[model samples]
Target: MRRILIVGAGQAGLQLALGLQAQDYDVTVMSNRTADEIRGGRVMSTQCMFDQALQHERDTQINFWESQAPRVQGLGVSVAAPDGSRAIDWLGHLDHYAQSVDQRLKMAGWLETFAQRGGQLVVHGAAVSDLDFFARTYDLVLVAAGKGELVSMFARDAERSPYDAPQRALAVAYVHGLGPRPEHPDTEAVRCNLVPGVGELFVIPCLTTSGRCDTLFWEGVPGGPLDVFRDIKDPAEHLATTLELMEKFLPWEYARATKVELTDAGGTLAGRYAPTVRKPVGRLPGGGAVLGVADVVVANDPITGQGSNSASKCAAAYLAAILEHGDRPFDEAWMQATFDRYWETARHVTTWTNAMLAPPPEHVVNMLGAAGELQPVADRFANGFNNPADFEEWFYDPAKTEAYLASVTG
Candidate 1:
């Protein structure tokens, strides 16, 4: 039996462990902290798993996704322009889709599944100084240390652009007491607004510990109206600043949900909200190979909510590669095939969404006004996000995007 050691028991690591164990590989997962520690601690991040990814979970493991559907079935999204003007209802594009549970719960559930299947979990305290020991011990070692820690591993090979500039830091709050669906609720779905020279504000529904739905949200683009709240030490002020910013940038929805309360709501979610962090796919100088996934490699402005979905898709592909090449060294060919497959798969959608959030191109603005024609294009684009293989087959193929563009435009 092949022995494998996976570092970082977060989403990708846990998912890989479960898949490999089912294939009957000798698998052990090591994380810097215990499962309870990771679950109870850590600043909460939002994760949205699409229908396809959920189905992947179901197809792979019988009970995997079945446990989380209450939170996954109905997903809603919308776009708000600077003046609080509405674009096409983003929910329409997502009505056919399903979402996943919070990141922490999702990871915990999967980790438990891995353990039940005869996999081992070791909580290795912060930092593993050497991989040579592990390389000798296990048939393969997978690293998925998220955001900040993963950056250094890819510093040398990445090309940086101004778009990489962290235009704004994000302040997210996971709040409760937001009452379960008011009779005439503001918007029936998640809300996103673009405040011209200011920043973007996004509020989406999430599940609370009470099992009632509340919102896991963020106020974006750090330099504008809420800049004063940037460095505050007070939790109340942090929540206050988010409220103030929401009122200014997203008045309609804010007005509708004024009475909703906030929990652990406040200050910058990350001290520095925005910084350009993109790295090339390759190995670390210390010898073990590492490929950046999700926010680590493709940290884009969260204005699109594509971060988690994108990460999950990349992870699924990565998992598939490991299962197929059993006992084979994860060599340069496998690495390139896997990493480049992710890049080729995700690059277009990532780029297109980034462009939408950036200073809008005139053509895009014009295209939005005639949304009747653009709606189907928007739906397909949103659906395509779930699986990149489908995307390449439909949009990125030599002449497909042009045809797709024409069909939407006409």
Candidate 2:
């Protein structure tokens, strides 16, 4: 049994750990917080797992919340006009459903699962110095902690990373009593409202520690009017401010959010990070080599909600890479090749997501508008959430978009 140490207990780390445990490899995970501490903590992210990613969890038998979580069946996008009315509005159907389960519920539950099943769980914050020591005992070490001092060990891959600073000021609140979209009275969907200059608003239905709820999130363009959540520490004030913004910029959404209340005192999250891609291997001061996983290596802005999805896929891809190596030394060459396998898919996600951060080019804008008139186009756009690679075929190029539109319209 080869011993492995994972320095983070997030989706990628935990999933990979559990998968290795089942295969009878000696596995250990280090988490900064215990399961109970995590359960009692604040919301972490605005994450929604689409079909492809969810299937990976199901394959590993780690999708314990499947029956309890709401199945978000589609995505509804509305571009706000100058007066806050919808300039173009349509709901695109996903071939299969997606879901959002709060990390407070998921990471905590997964932590417990990893421990309950005889995998070693270390409750401590791991730094590079810690890994320098642990590397002597474990045959392999992977860092999945996306944020922390540990991330600095993995240098940024300048060629792959474009932004040096954050593009959006993010704010999120989980609440109960958010009414359904009246237009799609029976649909369980994610709503994305795009405000050209200010930012974007997304309403995600999710299952949390409390039960099913909605996550009202904002991605404000940096230094823009909506970039205003940094100073408000009070959860009530945070929510109130969220509602006020909705009323002003997305009136229709505000109409339904009028009576909502926080799911708990810790149901709000506010912060920002630049989308970055880092080298796969982290080198310790003591000459120990460590591998970086998921957001630690390839952090997308979450503008397209790919954080959790990408993490799950990364774990799966790495699991396959490890299982195939069959006792090969986990060296720098192995780590880079492992990441290269995951990047085959992650590259598409990074490309599509990065493009969304900029104002859409005329061709992209035309395609979005066309979705309103073409059901097939809307369906393709919505389904792209599951596989962003599809966008490359028709979404990025002017000539491709023009040809695809002509083929569809006729």
Q: Each prediction's Cα lDDT score?
A: 0.58, 0.94
Q: Write the per-residue lDDT of candidate 1 for residues 278-383, one digit (tens) a residue.
A: 5535464566664455556656556656666666666778777777787777765676677676677567556555565567655444433434356665555555
Scored by lDDT, the top model is 2
Per-residue error at 156 for model 1, in Å? 4.8
Misplaced by over 4 Å in model 1 are: 62-91, 126-128, 148-150, 160-164, 177-188, 227-229, 263-268, 271-295, 372-410
Model 2: which residue pairs collide? Answer: none
Worst 10 residues of 1 by lDDT: 68-77
Q: CA shift at 16, candidate 2, in angstroms?
A: 0.8
Worst 10-residue lDDT window for candidate 2 reads 323-332
- The local distance difference test score of model 1 is 0.58
**lDDT of predicted model 2:** 0.94
TM-score of every candidate relative to the true structure? 0.81, 0.99
> Candidate 2 has what TM-score?
0.99
